[model samples]
Target: MAESKTNAMRLLDKSQIPYETLNYDHEDGQIHGTAVAEKIGRPQESVFKTLVAHQSGQISQICVFVIPVAEELDLKKAAKAAGAKKIEMLPVKDLLKWTGYIRGGCSPVGMKKLYPTFIDASAEGLKIIAVSAGRIGTQMELNPQQLAEQVKAVFFPLTKEA
Candidate 1:
């Protein structure tokens, strides 16, 4: 398959950030984060999914989170990290309206706006991490710290305890 370029990929290129693109079969329509991680042969902990959430009662106030595909977001922890009283996952229907990306294709980079972003603290020690390349079937692997820096994200405990 020919390589496809996405806004996230383009942004990384413009910033001169080093990243490797990984593609997997999306034709089956199984585009879940965990599936993508497994298909790419990367450890679950090293592949993250981008989630969008909103401050309770304030649809306008949004934040982005990047957590391991195998884990679930802890709303309490995420709220604390985001300095929000309460946080709720943004409805899938509104994802594109806000982040310009749909479920399973959201990327932490190149959102419609630079909303507050927080990466799971677990990613801190990782040499590299993979995130969506702003489209289904594509992912970009790069240094975790560099990914956070590029998106102005902070490391925080945002996942539920297993």
Candidate 2:
């Protein structure tokens, strides 16, 4: 059943990141990340969502953000970390093309390209965390360090009060 979803299972197999797959009835038109956390009975802080952003100016760069659902990404801090002046969230279509995942189900692993990946420093404190397995109604639990390693991510203080 888990293998039915291509994206998440692909990463699990490719990276050899041991994970437990969880499936729940995904409510139609539900608000995303938070709802998934609630369904799994985990604090929103322990569930991260992936976002894609594009930097402006001559050196345009595509970046991936992995942050807790309960926290807001500090654009300034992210820009500083990415060596950009400003960063803007990319359109959903662009996100799909770049990350190979949809808006509500993006995962840092198994992306179409290896962009600059940034994971909030808070994630480092957790022994295990959940992230989208590239689709709605599906999630995976894995060690934060292994997740970062698989994505080649840089840990930084990229989050702030929501």
Q: TM-score for all predictions?
A: 0.97, 0.90
lDDT over C-alpha atoms for residue 113 of model 2: 80
- Which of the numbered candidates is closest to the native, going by highest TM-score? 1
What lDDT score is found at residue 21 in candidate 1? 93
lDDT of 1 by residue, 8-51 (tens): 98999999999999989999999988889889999999999999
lDDT of 2 by residue, 1-162 (tens): 325855656766777778887776777666477888888888998999887888975324799899998778888988988998998888776776667778777878778888899999999999999988878777888999998888889889998655
- RMSD after Cα superposition, model 2: 1.9
Record all residue pairs in model 2 with backbone atoms less than 3 Å apart, i.e. clashing. Answer: none
Q: What are the lDDT figures for the candidates, one per model?
A: 0.94, 0.82
